[model samples]
Target: MPLILFNKPFQVLCQFTPQEGRESLADYLSIPGIYPAGRLDADSEGLMLLTDDGKLQHKIAHPDHKEAKTYLVQVDGAIDAAALARLQAPLDLGDFVTKPSKAVRIAEPDWLWPRNPPIRERADKPTSWVAITLEEGKNRQVRRMTAAVGFPTLRLVRSSIGPFSLATHPLMPGDFIEVPANAIHK
Candidate 1:
Protein backbone atom coordinates (compact mmCIF):
# COMPACT_ATOMS: atom_id res chain seq x y z
CA MET A 1 0.00 0.00 0.00
CA PRO A 2 1.20 3.52 -0.74
CA LEU A 3 1.59 5.98 2.12
CA ILE A 4 0.57 9.58 1.58
CA LEU A 5 1.64 12.61 3.54
CA PHE A 6 -0.75 15.53 3.49
CA ASN A 7 -0.31 19.05 4.74
CA LYS A 8 -3.84 19.78 5.88
CA PRO A 9 -4.76 23.44 5.95
CA PHE A 10 -6.56 25.26 8.74
CA GLN A 11 -10.30 24.64 8.96
CA VAL A 12 -10.05 21.52 6.79
CA LEU A 13 -11.41 18.27 8.17
CA CYS A 14 -9.05 15.34 8.24
CA GLN A 15 -11.49 12.70 7.03
CA PHE A 16 -13.70 12.15 4.03
CA THR A 17 -16.79 12.57 6.17
CA PRO A 18 -18.77 15.55 4.96
CA GLN A 19 -19.18 18.31 7.49
CA GLU A 20 -21.97 20.85 7.60
CA GLY A 21 -20.67 23.63 5.36
CA ARG A 22 -17.05 22.89 6.25
CA GLU A 23 -14.15 21.69 4.10
CA SER A 24 -13.03 18.09 4.35
CA LEU A 25 -10.39 15.74 3.02
CA ALA A 26 -12.68 15.03 0.08
CA ASP A 27 -12.04 18.58 -1.07
CA TYR A 28 -8.27 18.16 -1.11
CA LEU A 29 -7.31 14.54 -1.76
CA SER A 30 -8.36 12.57 -4.82
CA ILE A 31 -6.42 9.37 -4.30
CA PRO A 32 -8.70 6.35 -4.15
CA GLY A 33 -8.43 3.44 -1.70
CA ILE A 34 -6.48 5.37 0.92
CA TYR A 35 -7.66 6.61 4.30
CA PRO A 36 -6.18 8.72 7.06
CA ALA A 37 -3.73 7.06 9.41
CA GLY A 38 -4.68 9.59 12.06
CA ARG A 39 -6.34 12.98 12.26
CA LEU A 40 -5.71 16.68 12.70
CA ASP A 41 -8.55 18.85 13.96
CA ALA A 42 -10.37 21.13 11.58
CA ASP A 43 -9.08 24.10 13.52
CA SER A 44 -5.47 22.89 13.28
CA GLU A 45 -3.05 22.73 10.36
CA GLY A 46 -0.13 20.52 9.35
CA LEU A 47 1.00 16.99 8.69
CA MET A 48 -1.33 14.01 8.30
CA LEU A 49 -0.72 10.45 7.16
CA LEU A 50 -2.88 8.29 4.92
CA THR A 51 -2.58 4.72 3.75
CA ASP A 52 -4.56 1.86 2.28
CA ASP A 53 -2.86 -0.77 4.41
CA GLY A 54 -4.59 -1.33 7.73
CA LYS A 55 -1.43 -2.60 9.36
CA LEU A 56 0.60 0.43 8.36
CA GLN A 57 -2.19 2.67 9.55
CA HIS A 58 -2.18 0.92 12.86
CA LYS A 59 1.57 1.20 13.15
CA ILE A 60 1.47 4.94 12.57
CA ALA A 61 -1.66 5.97 14.44
CA HIS A 62 -1.98 3.45 17.24
CA PRO A 63 -0.91 4.73 20.65
CA ASP A 64 1.09 1.58 21.29
CA HIS A 65 3.46 2.49 18.50
CA LYS A 66 4.48 5.68 20.35
CA GLU A 67 5.44 7.57 17.23
CA ALA A 68 6.61 11.07 18.07
CA LYS A 69 4.72 13.97 16.53
CA THR A 70 6.21 17.46 16.48
CA TYR A 71 4.30 20.71 16.28
CA LEU A 72 5.10 24.40 15.93
CA VAL A 73 2.71 26.40 18.08
CA GLN A 74 2.01 30.09 18.52
CA VAL A 75 0.64 30.88 21.91
CA ASP A 76 -1.24 33.89 23.27
CA GLY A 77 1.34 34.89 25.83
CA ALA A 78 5.07 35.07 26.34
CA ILE A 79 6.46 31.59 26.99
CA ASP A 80 9.16 31.11 29.56
CA ALA A 81 11.57 28.28 30.22
CA ALA A 82 9.63 27.24 33.32
CA ALA A 83 6.44 26.79 31.33
CA LEU A 84 8.35 24.83 28.72
CA ALA A 85 9.80 22.61 31.41
CA ARG A 86 6.33 21.91 32.72
CA LEU A 87 5.33 20.75 29.27
CA GLN A 88 8.31 18.42 29.10
CA ALA A 89 7.27 16.91 32.43
CA PRO A 90 4.22 14.69 32.78
CA LEU A 91 0.96 16.42 33.45
CA ASP A 92 -2.09 15.21 35.37
CA LEU A 93 -4.77 15.88 32.76
CA GLY A 94 -7.60 14.41 34.89
CA ASP A 95 -8.31 11.32 32.77
CA PHE A 96 -4.65 10.35 32.46
CA VAL A 97 -1.11 11.56 32.91
CA THR A 98 0.44 12.73 29.68
CA LYS A 99 3.74 11.28 28.52
CA PRO A 100 7.01 13.16 28.56
CA SER A 101 7.22 15.72 25.78
CA LYS A 102 9.69 18.32 24.51
CA ALA A 103 9.11 22.06 24.34
CA VAL A 104 11.39 24.90 23.30
CA ARG A 105 10.92 28.47 22.24
CA ILE A 106 11.39 29.34 18.58
CA ALA A 107 11.24 32.38 16.39
CA GLU A 108 8.09 32.91 14.37
CA PRO A 109 8.38 31.97 10.71
CA ASP A 110 8.38 34.89 8.25
CA TRP A 111 6.66 32.94 5.49
CA LEU A 112 3.44 31.91 7.26
CA TRP A 113 0.42 32.96 5.26
CA PRO A 114 -2.30 34.99 6.93
CA ARG A 115 -4.96 32.80 8.52
CA ASN A 116 -8.22 32.81 6.60
CA PRO A 117 -10.43 34.07 9.42
CA PRO A 118 -7.39 35.58 11.07
CA ILE A 119 -6.23 35.10 14.60
CA ARG A 120 -7.14 38.02 16.83
CA GLU A 121 -4.25 40.39 17.25
CA ARG A 122 -3.76 42.56 20.29
CA ALA A 123 -1.04 45.16 20.11
CA ASP A 124 -0.76 45.22 23.88
CA LYS A 125 -0.84 41.46 24.28
CA PRO A 126 2.22 39.41 23.46
CA THR A 127 2.71 36.04 21.77
CA SER A 128 5.48 33.50 21.54
CA TRP A 129 6.39 30.46 19.49
CA VAL A 130 7.29 27.03 20.70
CA ALA A 131 8.07 23.70 19.11
CA ILE A 132 6.61 20.76 20.97
CA THR A 133 6.97 17.03 20.49
CA LEU A 134 4.77 14.33 21.94
CA GLU A 135 4.79 10.57 21.64
CA GLU A 136 1.10 10.22 22.44
CA GLY A 137 -1.79 11.54 20.41
CA LYS A 138 -4.74 12.85 22.35
CA ASN A 139 -7.75 14.99 21.73
CA ARG A 140 -6.46 18.54 21.21
CA GLN A 141 -3.42 17.53 23.18
CA VAL A 142 -1.20 20.39 22.04
CA ARG A 143 -3.86 23.00 22.66
CA ARG A 144 -4.80 21.60 26.02
CA MET A 145 -1.23 21.12 27.10
CA THR A 146 -0.19 24.64 26.22
CA ALA A 147 -3.28 26.09 27.85
CA ALA A 148 -2.55 24.11 30.96
CA VAL A 149 0.85 25.72 31.06
CA GLY A 150 -0.86 29.15 30.94
CA PHE A 151 -0.18 29.89 27.29
CA PRO A 152 -3.25 29.22 25.19
CA THR A 153 -2.45 28.31 21.60
CA LEU A 154 -3.19 30.90 18.94
CA ARG A 155 -2.00 28.75 16.04
CA LEU A 156 -0.77 25.19 15.72
CA VAL A 157 1.04 23.30 12.96
CA ARG A 158 2.49 19.84 12.90
CA SER A 159 6.03 20.06 11.59
CA SER A 160 6.98 16.39 11.64
CA ILE A 161 5.71 12.90 12.25
CA GLY A 162 7.93 9.99 13.19
CA PRO A 163 10.41 9.77 10.31
CA PHE A 164 8.81 12.34 8.01
CA SER A 165 9.52 16.05 8.21
CA LEU A 166 7.41 18.77 6.66
CA ALA A 167 10.60 20.80 6.21
CA THR A 168 11.68 18.61 3.30
CA HIS A 169 8.24 18.15 1.70
CA PRO A 170 7.22 21.86 2.06
CA LEU A 171 3.51 21.60 1.46
CA MET A 172 1.48 24.73 1.09
CA PRO A 173 -2.04 24.64 2.43
CA GLY A 174 -4.14 21.80 0.98
CA ASP A 175 -1.25 20.17 -0.84
CA PHE A 176 -0.32 16.49 -0.57
CA ILE A 177 2.44 14.16 -1.68
CA GLU A 178 2.72 10.39 -2.06
CA VAL A 179 5.54 8.52 -0.38
CA PRO A 180 6.60 5.14 -1.65
CA ALA A 181 6.38 2.46 1.02
CA ASN A 182 10.15 2.02 1.12
CA ALA A 183 10.68 5.74 1.73
CA ILE A 184 8.45 5.81 4.80
CA HIS A 185 10.79 4.10 7.26
CA LYS A 186 13.98 5.64 5.92
Candidate 2:
Protein backbone atom coordinates (compact mmCIF):
# COMPACT_ATOMS: atom_id res chain seq x y z
CA MET A 1 0.00 0.00 0.00
CA PRO A 2 1.11 3.55 -0.67
CA LEU A 3 1.49 6.24 1.97
CA ILE A 4 -1.10 9.01 2.37
CA LEU A 5 0.09 12.55 2.88
CA PHE A 6 -2.52 14.76 4.51
CA ASN A 7 -2.78 18.40 5.44
CA LYS A 8 -4.27 18.23 8.91
CA PRO A 9 -6.20 21.28 10.06
CA PHE A 10 -6.18 22.92 13.43
CA GLN A 11 -8.11 21.39 16.33
CA VAL A 12 -8.40 17.97 14.69
CA LEU A 13 -7.36 15.14 16.95
CA CYS A 14 -4.62 12.79 15.79
CA GLN A 15 -6.44 9.50 16.27
CA PHE A 16 -8.92 7.30 14.47
CA THR A 17 -10.77 6.52 17.69
CA PRO A 18 -13.70 8.82 18.26
CA GLN A 19 -13.74 11.28 21.12
CA GLU A 20 -16.54 13.43 22.47
CA GLY A 21 -16.92 16.75 20.63
CA ARG A 22 -13.62 16.32 18.86
CA GLU A 23 -12.87 15.39 15.26
CA SER A 24 -10.44 12.54 14.65
CA LEU A 25 -8.59 11.11 11.66
CA ALA A 26 -11.70 9.07 11.00
CA ASP A 27 -13.55 12.25 10.05
CA TYR A 28 -11.23 13.00 7.15
CA LEU A 29 -10.02 9.51 6.35
CA SER A 30 -12.18 6.52 5.62
CA ILE A 31 -9.29 4.46 4.27
CA PRO A 32 -9.32 1.28 6.30
CA GLY A 33 -6.27 0.21 8.38
CA ILE A 34 -4.23 3.30 7.65
CA TYR A 35 -2.55 4.84 10.72
CA PRO A 36 -0.60 8.05 11.18
CA ALA A 37 3.17 7.57 10.93
CA GLY A 38 3.57 10.27 13.61
CA ARG A 39 1.14 12.40 15.56
CA LEU A 40 0.55 16.14 15.36
CA ASP A 41 -1.28 17.54 18.36
CA ALA A 42 -4.87 18.66 17.87
CA ASP A 43 -3.76 22.27 18.17
CA SER A 44 -1.11 21.82 15.50
CA GLU A 45 -1.62 21.83 11.75
CA GLY A 46 -0.11 20.64 8.41
CA LEU A 47 1.69 17.63 6.95
CA MET A 48 0.98 14.14 8.22
CA LEU A 49 1.73 10.74 6.70
CA LEU A 50 -0.58 7.79 7.07
CA THR A 51 0.24 4.22 6.14
CA ASP A 52 -1.31 0.82 6.49
CA ASP A 53 2.04 -0.87 6.94
CA GLY A 54 2.88 -1.31 10.61
CA LYS A 55 6.63 -1.45 10.12
CA LEU A 56 6.65 1.74 8.08
CA GLN A 57 4.57 3.52 10.67
CA HIS A 58 6.91 2.47 13.46
CA LYS A 59 9.95 3.43 11.47
CA ILE A 60 8.73 6.99 11.04
CA ALA A 61 7.34 7.46 14.53
CA HIS A 62 10.07 5.82 16.58
CA PRO A 63 12.66 8.11 18.13
CA ASP A 64 15.44 5.73 17.15
CA HIS A 65 15.14 6.74 13.51
CA LYS A 66 15.70 10.38 14.40
CA GLU A 67 13.46 11.33 11.51
CA ALA A 68 13.72 15.05 10.96
CA LYS A 69 10.49 16.96 11.49
CA THR A 70 10.32 20.65 10.68
CA TYR A 71 7.79 23.09 12.06
CA LEU A 72 6.86 26.66 11.13
CA VAL A 73 6.24 28.23 14.48
CA GLN A 74 4.47 31.55 14.89
CA VAL A 75 5.41 32.93 18.23
CA ASP A 76 4.78 35.96 20.41
CA GLY A 77 7.36 38.80 20.39
CA ALA A 78 9.97 39.77 17.80
CA ILE A 79 11.91 36.43 18.11
CA ASP A 80 15.34 38.06 18.10
CA ALA A 81 18.74 36.53 17.42
CA ALA A 82 19.15 35.50 21.08
CA ALA A 83 16.01 33.35 21.04
CA LEU A 84 16.91 31.83 17.68
CA ALA A 85 20.33 30.82 18.96
CA ARG A 86 18.82 29.40 22.13
CA LEU A 87 16.38 27.34 20.12
CA GLN A 88 19.15 25.92 17.92
CA ALA A 89 20.98 24.75 21.02
CA PRO A 90 19.48 22.23 23.42
CA LEU A 91 17.68 23.77 26.35
CA ASP A 92 16.49 21.72 29.30
CA LEU A 93 12.71 21.58 29.19
CA GLY A 94 12.70 20.16 32.77
CA ASP A 95 11.19 16.78 31.91
CA PHE A 96 13.89 15.97 29.36
CA VAL A 97 16.73 17.69 27.58
CA THR A 98 16.37 18.17 23.85
CA LYS A 99 19.00 17.53 21.20
CA PRO A 100 20.48 20.42 19.19
CA SER A 101 18.20 21.52 16.38
CA LYS A 102 18.08 23.78 13.32
CA ALA A 103 16.29 27.02 14.10
CA VAL A 104 16.20 30.14 11.95
CA ARG A 105 13.90 33.10 11.63
CA ILE A 106 11.83 33.10 8.50
CA ALA A 107 9.24 35.34 6.96
CA GLU A 108 5.68 34.03 7.13
CA PRO A 109 5.41 31.47 4.38
CA ASP A 110 3.66 32.79 1.31
CA TRP A 111 1.96 29.47 0.74
CA LEU A 112 0.61 29.19 4.28
CA TRP A 113 -3.12 29.05 4.64
CA PRO A 114 -4.69 30.81 7.57
CA ARG A 115 -5.90 28.82 10.55
CA ASN A 116 -9.68 28.45 10.76
CA PRO A 117 -9.59 30.16 14.13
CA PRO A 118 -6.68 32.51 13.64
CA ILE A 119 -4.07 32.98 16.31
CA ARG A 120 -4.49 35.74 18.86
CA GLU A 121 -2.96 39.11 18.12
CA ARG A 122 -2.23 41.78 20.68
CA ALA A 123 -2.16 45.43 19.73
CA ASP A 124 1.26 45.99 21.26
CA LYS A 125 2.79 42.67 20.36
CA PRO A 126 4.19 41.38 17.10
CA THR A 127 4.50 37.71 16.19
CA SER A 128 7.45 36.20 14.38
CA TRP A 129 7.95 32.97 12.48
CA VAL A 130 10.74 30.49 13.00
CA ALA A 131 11.53 27.38 11.05
CA ILE A 132 12.71 24.75 13.49
CA THR A 133 13.83 21.28 12.52
CA LEU A 134 14.45 18.58 15.05
CA GLU A 135 15.53 15.00 14.60
CA GLU A 136 13.76 13.79 17.74
CA GLY A 137 10.25 15.00 18.47
CA LYS A 138 9.23 14.63 22.06
CA ASN A 139 5.67 15.43 23.05
CA ARG A 140 4.89 19.12 22.37
CA GLN A 141 8.59 19.79 22.04
CA VAL A 142 8.34 22.78 19.70
CA ARG A 143 5.70 24.49 21.78
CA ARG A 144 7.66 23.88 24.94
CA MET A 145 10.90 25.00 23.38
CA THR A 146 9.49 28.34 22.24
CA ALA A 147 7.85 29.05 25.59
CA ALA A 148 11.13 28.34 27.33
CA VAL A 149 12.82 30.94 25.18
CA GLY A 150 10.22 33.59 26.20
CA PHE A 151 8.37 33.58 22.90
CA PRO A 152 5.36 31.32 23.35
CA THR A 153 4.13 29.58 20.24
CA LEU A 154 0.88 31.01 18.93
CA ARG A 155 0.64 28.71 15.95
CA LEU A 156 2.40 25.44 15.23
CA VAL A 157 2.50 23.89 11.78
CA ARG A 158 4.46 20.85 10.71
CA SER A 159 5.88 21.70 7.28
CA SER A 160 7.76 18.44 6.64
CA ILE A 161 8.87 15.10 7.94
CA GLY A 162 11.96 13.30 6.72
CA PRO A 163 12.07 13.47 2.92
CA PHE A 164 8.34 14.27 2.51
CA SER A 165 7.32 17.88 2.72
CA LEU A 166 4.47 20.28 2.15
CA ALA A 167 6.75 22.12 -0.25
CA THR A 168 7.21 18.99 -2.36
CA HIS A 169 3.59 17.91 -2.00
CA PRO A 170 1.35 20.85 -1.18
CA LEU A 171 -2.13 20.08 0.06
CA MET A 172 -4.78 22.26 1.63
CA PRO A 173 -6.29 21.42 4.99
CA GLY A 174 -8.27 18.16 4.91
CA ASP A 175 -6.71 17.25 1.58
CA PHE A 176 -4.71 14.05 1.07
CA ILE A 177 -2.90 12.21 -1.67
CA GLU A 178 -1.34 8.79 -2.02
CA VAL A 179 2.35 8.55 -2.86
CA PRO A 180 4.81 5.68 -3.14
CA ALA A 181 5.51 4.20 0.26
CA ASN A 182 9.23 4.23 -0.51
CA ALA A 183 9.23 7.97 -1.25
CA ILE A 184 10.62 8.79 2.15
CA HIS A 185 13.59 6.47 1.68
CA LYS A 186 14.75 8.31 -1.44
Candidate 3:
Protein backbone atom coordinates (compact mmCIF):
# COMPACT_ATOMS: atom_id res chain seq x y z
CA MET A 1 0.00 0.00 0.00
CA PRO A 2 1.40 3.38 -0.98
CA LEU A 3 0.30 6.10 1.41
CA ILE A 4 1.81 9.56 1.25
CA LEU A 5 1.61 12.53 3.55
CA PHE A 6 2.02 15.84 1.71
CA ASN A 7 2.29 19.36 3.06
CA LYS A 8 0.22 21.32 0.61
CA PRO A 9 1.11 24.95 0.17
CA PHE A 10 -1.30 27.82 -0.23
CA GLN A 11 -2.67 28.43 -3.74
CA VAL A 12 -1.83 24.90 -4.84
CA LEU A 13 -4.67 22.88 -6.27
CA CYS A 14 -5.33 19.50 -4.64
CA GLN A 15 -5.46 17.46 -7.82
CA PHE A 16 -2.52 16.23 -9.82
CA THR A 17 -3.76 17.53 -13.19
CA PRO A 18 -2.30 20.81 -14.27
CA GLN A 19 -4.54 23.86 -14.12
CA GLU A 20 -4.00 26.95 -16.20
CA GLY A 21 -1.81 29.50 -14.36
CA ARG A 22 -2.19 27.64 -11.06
CA GLU A 23 0.01 25.17 -9.26
CA SER A 24 -1.30 21.64 -8.89
CA LEU A 25 -0.14 18.66 -6.83
CA ALA A 26 1.71 17.54 -9.92
CA ASP A 27 4.04 20.50 -9.52
CA TYR A 28 5.19 19.00 -6.24
CA LEU A 29 4.25 15.32 -6.49
CA SER A 30 5.93 13.19 -9.10
CA ILE A 31 4.78 9.81 -7.85
CA PRO A 32 2.44 7.88 -10.12
CA GLY A 33 -0.97 6.33 -9.38
CA ILE A 34 -1.67 8.14 -6.11
CA TYR A 35 -4.67 10.42 -5.54
CA PRO A 36 -5.69 12.81 -2.77
CA ALA A 37 -8.01 11.29 -0.16
CA GLY A 38 -9.59 14.67 0.60
CA ARG A 39 -9.32 18.15 -0.87
CA LEU A 40 -8.02 21.36 0.59
CA ASP A 41 -9.04 24.42 -1.39
CA ALA A 42 -6.25 26.30 -3.13
CA ASP A 43 -6.50 29.08 -0.58
CA SER A 44 -5.93 26.75 2.40
CA GLU A 45 -2.71 25.04 3.30
CA GLY A 46 -1.39 22.01 5.25
CA LEU A 47 -1.67 18.25 5.67
CA MET A 48 -2.94 16.27 2.65
CA LEU A 49 -3.00 12.51 2.36
CA LEU A 50 -2.68 10.59 -0.89
CA THR A 51 -2.99 6.92 -1.59
CA ASP A 52 -3.40 4.28 -4.27
CA ASP A 53 -5.75 2.15 -2.19
CA GLY A 54 -9.35 2.97 -3.00
CA LYS A 55 -10.71 1.63 0.30
CA LEU A 56 -8.33 3.70 2.42
CA GLN A 57 -9.08 6.79 0.36
CA HIS A 58 -12.79 6.47 0.96
CA LYS A 59 -12.34 5.78 4.63
CA ILE A 60 -10.27 8.90 5.01
CA ALA A 61 -12.39 11.20 2.88
CA HIS A 62 -15.92 10.03 3.51
CA PRO A 63 -17.86 12.04 6.08
CA ASP A 64 -19.72 8.97 7.19
CA HIS A 65 -16.47 7.66 8.57
CA LYS A 66 -16.29 10.64 10.88
CA GLU A 67 -12.54 10.96 10.78
CA ALA A 68 -11.61 14.13 12.59
CA LYS A 69 -9.51 16.76 10.86
CA THR A 70 -7.88 19.50 12.93
CA TYR A 71 -7.10 22.99 11.68
CA LEU A 72 -5.14 25.97 12.92
CA VAL A 73 -7.00 29.07 11.87
CA GLN A 74 -6.20 32.77 12.00
CA VAL A 75 -9.25 35.00 12.15
CA ASP A 76 -9.38 38.70 11.20
CA GLY A 77 -10.36 39.98 14.64
CA ALA A 78 -10.12 38.84 18.22
CA ILE A 79 -12.47 35.97 18.96
CA ASP A 80 -14.67 36.29 22.01
CA ALA A 81 -16.23 33.54 24.12
CA ALA A 82 -19.58 34.11 22.40
CA ALA A 83 -17.93 33.51 19.04
CA LEU A 84 -16.37 30.32 20.35
CA ALA A 85 -19.72 29.10 21.63
CA ARG A 86 -21.35 29.75 18.26
CA LEU A 87 -18.58 27.93 16.49
CA GLN A 88 -18.87 24.93 18.79
CA ALA A 89 -22.60 24.73 18.19
CA PRO A 90 -23.94 22.98 15.11
CA LEU A 91 -23.69 25.44 12.25
CA ASP A 92 -26.07 25.60 9.35
CA LEU A 93 -24.03 26.35 6.25
CA GLY A 94 -27.15 26.66 4.01
CA ASP A 95 -26.24 23.53 2.09
CA PHE A 96 -26.06 21.36 5.21
CA VAL A 97 -25.83 21.61 8.97
CA THR A 98 -22.37 20.90 10.21
CA LYS A 99 -21.97 18.45 13.07
CA PRO A 100 -20.95 19.85 16.44
CA SER A 101 -17.28 20.66 16.41
CA LYS A 102 -14.61 21.70 18.89
CA ALA A 103 -13.42 25.28 18.56
CA VAL A 104 -11.13 27.04 21.00
CA ARG A 105 -8.62 29.84 20.99
CA ILE A 106 -5.02 28.66 20.96
CA ALA A 107 -1.67 30.34 20.87
CA GLU A 108 -0.15 30.47 17.40
CA PRO A 109 1.65 27.18 16.91
CA ASP A 110 5.39 27.78 17.05
CA TRP A 111 6.13 24.97 14.58
CA LEU A 112 4.03 26.46 11.77
CA TRP A 113 5.84 27.73 8.71
CA PRO A 114 5.12 31.20 7.34
CA ARG A 115 2.95 31.08 4.26
CA ASN A 116 4.25 32.50 1.01
CA PRO A 117 2.78 35.90 0.00
CA PRO A 118 1.92 36.07 3.73
CA ILE A 119 -1.64 36.79 4.78
CA ARG A 120 -2.36 40.51 4.54
CA GLU A 121 -1.77 42.37 7.76
CA ARG A 122 -4.38 44.83 9.02
CA ALA A 123 -3.13 47.52 11.35
CA ASP A 124 -6.61 48.45 12.48
CA LYS A 125 -7.70 44.96 13.56
CA PRO A 126 -5.63 42.46 15.44
CA THR A 127 -5.79 38.81 14.37
CA SER A 128 -6.11 35.80 16.67
CA TRP A 129 -5.63 32.06 16.29
CA VAL A 130 -8.11 29.29 16.91
CA ALA A 131 -7.99 25.54 16.78
CA ILE A 132 -10.96 23.86 15.13
CA THR A 133 -11.49 20.16 14.78
CA LEU A 134 -14.27 18.78 12.62
CA GLU A 135 -15.35 15.34 11.56
CA GLU A 136 -16.73 16.44 8.23
CA GLY A 137 -14.93 17.88 5.23
CA LYS A 138 -17.18 20.52 3.72
CA ASN A 139 -16.21 22.99 1.05
CA ARG A 140 -14.08 25.64 2.78
CA GLN A 141 -15.93 24.80 5.97
CA VAL A 142 -13.53 26.43 8.42
CA ARG A 143 -13.47 29.68 6.48
CA ARG A 144 -17.25 29.71 6.25
CA MET A 145 -17.71 28.92 9.93
CA THR A 146 -15.41 31.70 11.09
CA ALA A 147 -17.06 34.24 8.80
CA ALA A 148 -20.50 33.21 9.94
CA VAL A 149 -19.44 33.78 13.52
CA GLY A 150 -18.28 37.34 12.60
CA PHE A 151 -14.55 36.66 12.46
CA PRO A 152 -13.47 36.04 8.91
CA THR A 153 -10.76 33.47 8.53
CA LEU A 154 -7.56 35.07 7.33
CA ARG A 155 -5.56 31.88 7.06
CA LEU A 156 -6.46 28.19 7.36
CA VAL A 157 -4.13 25.28 7.84
CA ARG A 158 -5.11 21.67 8.43
CA SER A 159 -2.71 20.31 11.01
CA SER A 160 -3.95 16.75 11.19
CA ILE A 161 -6.39 14.22 9.83
CA GLY A 162 -7.40 11.55 12.30
CA PRO A 163 -4.25 10.02 13.75
CA PHE A 164 -2.06 11.28 10.93
CA SER A 165 -0.47 14.64 11.72
CA LEU A 166 1.93 17.03 10.05
CA ALA A 167 3.84 17.21 13.30
CA THR A 168 4.55 13.46 13.34
CA HIS A 169 5.89 13.57 9.81
CA PRO A 170 7.39 17.05 10.03
CA LEU A 171 7.05 17.61 6.30
CA MET A 172 7.65 21.07 4.85
CA PRO A 173 5.51 22.59 2.11
CA GLY A 174 5.67 20.54 -1.08
CA ASP A 175 7.42 17.71 0.75
CA PHE A 176 5.95 14.25 1.28
CA ILE A 177 6.60 11.04 3.15
CA GLU A 178 5.34 7.61 2.17
CA VAL A 179 4.20 5.34 4.95
CA PRO A 180 2.65 1.93 5.27
CA ALA A 181 -1.10 1.87 5.07
CA ASN A 182 -1.35 0.45 8.58
CA ALA A 183 0.63 3.35 9.99
CA ILE A 184 -2.50 5.46 10.30
CA HIS A 185 -4.62 4.35 13.26
CA LYS A 186 -7.94 5.95 14.04
Among the numbered candidates, top TM-score falls to 2
Clash pairs for candidate 1: none
Cα lDDT tens digits for candidate 1, 1-186: 789989899999888989899999999988888999888998899899899988888888888885789999999999998999999999877787899999999998665656778889999999999999999989999999999989999999998898887887888888888888666566
TM-score-based ranking: 2, 3, 1
In order, how many clashes per candidate? Answer: 0, 0, 0
TM-score of 3: 0.97
Compose the digit string of candidate 2's lDDT tens values, residues 1-186. 879999999999999999999999999999998999989999999999999998888889998875799999999999999999999998999999999999999999999998988888799999999999999998999999999999999999999999989987889999999999998777
Q: At residue 101, give the lDDT of candidate 1.
A: 94
- In candidate 1, which residue ranges exceed 4 Å CA deviation? none
- lDDT for each residue of candidate 3 in 107-129, tens digit (9 for 90 to 100): 99889999998999979999999
Better of 2 and 3 by lDDT: 2
TM-scores of the models, in the order given: 0.96, 0.98, 0.97
Model-by-model lDDT, in order?
Answer: 0.88, 0.93, 0.91
Error of 1 at 128 (Å): 0.4
When sorted by lDDT, best at the front, the candidate numbers are: 2, 3, 1
